[model samples]
Target: MNHFQTGRVSTNKNYFLMFLGRKGDSMIEQEIQGASVAWFKIAELIARREREKALGVCRLLAHSFPDRAYELQLEGDILWALEDTLAKDRYTQAAQLYEHNERWVEAIALYEHITTIYPIDYTALADLLFCYAMGNAYDLFTTLCNTLLHKTQTGMLSDTNYTTIMHQAQEKLQKYPTSQHTAWVNDFILWAATK
Candidate 1:
């Protein structure tokens, strides 16, 4: 080969090797693959009251990351800020994924939002109660249980499903080792029995 051609080829090969041998390549790849940085931009757009642009980004995010609950949740939050009822639908979808994955904190937050949007949504209430028990948030569970009892007194949560949810909670508590409800679980079951 000519001298100039040989030098150019060697330089290109060195550049390629440097790119391949770069440290933290996997970390760079993870940053590129993760959604946090993009979500931050979208959040900034929302904070700036650029709802339309933020909403467009939210839709794109949901489409690109279909399996992740956080994407839909962001969309739902934007919709809520816009006072759109479709927020609930998006929140419901996200909540289902979170619940299915046993991500109790995210599911609980979404379910709480759903309940505020629909205080009489018995299914959401049941789901929230189930999450509370599973997460071992006994204080919250007991407080909500009393409120639910009052709701029943007002003929609000009078359906058979409430009783079924109670039974489900009882069954969940009955599960050994995994259940942290070692001490007060029996009392909770008794409380359900009286309901």
Candidate 2:
């Protein structure tokens, strides 16, 4: 009779463990479904130009899935939109967000990313170059300048190309004043003149 009771007790324990396991799995599934719903709501808010609400949703998603690249990118986009809509200093915040995600290249590139869509955007290019220099990617800076110079020669760049490149070089010189980067930029300008 004692052996029968021990067997029954063991069976009961096994059943309890299986029940708990199923419960845990169901909870995880429910949480994932909740997260998906939240993400959908965020996308809706962003599309509707409800910037603050969208940003709040992005923040919550970011917190929930700290390592998710899509969530991080959404957060960055929200910040960018906020900056644009509010006419605020969004570049620094965007750069910080990229940095937090360990996307140093993108962050540095943003500092100088320019579109010929705006004739006066040379300043943005200069800013990007300075950021790259600050990030200690001297090789990348040199490569970019060379590429731009080549594009100008090929007539691929707009008529404003030469002035823009020169302006960028000069701006970088001011930022790195007495550094080797300044000297390098100066030398490149001189070389361009010779060519």
The global C-alpha lDDT for each of the candidates, from Candidate 1 onward, is 0.73, 0.62
| lDDT: worst 10-residue window of model 1 | 176-185
C-alpha RMSD of each candidate structure in angstroms: 10.1, 10.5
Q: What 10-residue stretch in candidate 2 is worst by lDDT? A: 111-120
Show pairs that collide, candidate 1.
Answer: none
In candidate 2, position 104 carries an lDDT of 56
Candidate 1: clashing residue pairs, number = 0
| lDDT assessment of candidate 1 | 0.73
TM-score of 1: 0.59
Candidate 1 Cα deviation (angstroms), residue 155: 3.9
Q: Give lDDT tens digits, candidate 2, residues 155-194.
A: 8776486667667757756754567767666777788777
